[model samples]
Target: MSTTPSTTPEVRDDSRPARIGIQLQPQHAQYPAIRAAAARVEEMGADIAFNWDHFYPLYGEPEGLHFECWTMLAAWAEATSRIEIGALVSCNSYRNPELLADMARTVDHISAHDAGTGRLVLGIGSGWFEKDYDEYGYEFGTAGGRLDKLRDDLPRIESRLGALNPAPTRKIPVLIGGGGEKKTLRLVAKHADIWHTFGDVETFTRKSAVLDERCAEIGRDPGEIERSVGVETVQDAETMFAAGARLFTIGVGGPDYDTAVLADLLAWRDDKNA
Candidate 1:
């Protein structure tokens, strides 16, 4: 793999047009409703469609209707023709890394059949959410412990992907999500092709500087990892882009997944690209 020196922002193609993603929160909705929303987002020209991984609703009623992440992604692989589909961040603690790799590979083939490119971004993170552990019978380990596990498992996931009988259509892009200044940022420098985080201009700038330090220490280029942020409004997208974010995602929940918010963001994306 190629690495970029930290001294320059020119390591990767900064000229690539800004891309928009929509996180269709899979909570408090029926399967068909979620399916329709997924199709709608792709039709509206989203570059990526994301669903989060969690067993129950993260907001509103604790017992709200929700669907599993990877299963829905497999369905999305068939339902949408253009948009890239995957979890915003899959919890690495939920499944063995090898199994997760196989699952991603299968979805790659499914999505590749729809669009020639196998559009699976393996967005992963050290697991959080105590309820997911308590109810699911996973060990509720310390955050540091979980991060350690993630560090150990990533290589295994990659090896498994390479060893599969019919290999993944393409090398699945690894997207690491978190904002920890120490371990997380260092891991992002070493492993991730995309790094997703949440912050305003100053926070993003500070964390990005730290990321640059981490990348430089390892002889990798900071620009090689795409910077992504969650945006709530057009102004938010603009601010993040100015702070060096190129991939912007907005989250919408169901019951009624509104496209108006997405429309505004997409228009902003068009203006930026133009």
Candidate 2:
């Protein structure tokens, strides 16, 4: 891992083109609908297709239709040929670290098919959502304890990825989603290839500055990590882009799973990238 200090904006590759990711909320819908949305996002020119990791609906009828994350990702791996696929952020507590690594490797290979590289992004985070832990029979420990587990398991994941009989087709990109300045950002500095968060430009800037400080302490270039933000529409992405976000993710909930907002964002991405 190259950790040479990136002291200024020029040290980082600001010329990298902006990209769009569409997160199809896997709630209130059936698998067929979710699968179609995955294909639709790709046809609409989304750079990546994401589904969240959760056991239940995040809103609007907590007990409504829902699906597991990794299994659906496996389906997406075979369903779409061009789109990158993964959970927006997999909870580190849900599965054993090594087992998760094997699962990811399998999906990576599946997505690669005949292409030389895989499109799987291993977006992971320390567990939140107390209901998931309680319902799934895992301990809903303190936030700090969960962070400790994530810190401990990241290396284990990497080791397992290395030790697999046939290694992952590509070095699977690891996207760590959180903005916790103390522990989460520090872990992002040490382990993440992409960092996803939610906030206005000011909050994004402040937390990103903290991330830069974390990277500096570890002698890692901040540019090694891609800055990601979840936005509601194209208008919301402008400020974040100006604030130096390169990856913009739009989340659409299910039942209808409308892609209007995602289309608008993709138009903006095309212009920006051009």
**Maximum-TM-score candidate:** 2
Q: What lDDT would candidate 1 get against the real structure?
A: 0.88
Question: CA lDDT of each candidate?
Answer: 0.88, 0.89
Mind sharing the TM-score for model 1?
A: 0.94
| RMSD of model 1 against the true structure | 3.7
Off by over 4 Å in 2: 1-13
In order of appearance, the predictions have TM-scores of 0.94, 0.95
Supply every candidate's count of residue pairs whose N, Cα or C atoms clash at under 3 angstroms. 1, 1
In model 1, the Cα lDDT at residue 3 comes to 38
Model 1 lDDT per residue over 1-274, tens place: 2233232222233565788999999999999999999999999999999999999999999998999999999999988878898898999999999999999999999999843779898999998989989999999889999999999999899899999978888888898999887799989999999999997777776777778789989999788889989999998988778768899999999889998989998998898898
* Tens-digit lDDT track of model 2 for 200-243: 77788778778888998999999889999999978788878877
Winning candidate number (lDDT): 2
Q: Positional deviation of 18 in candidate 2, in angstroms?
A: 0.6
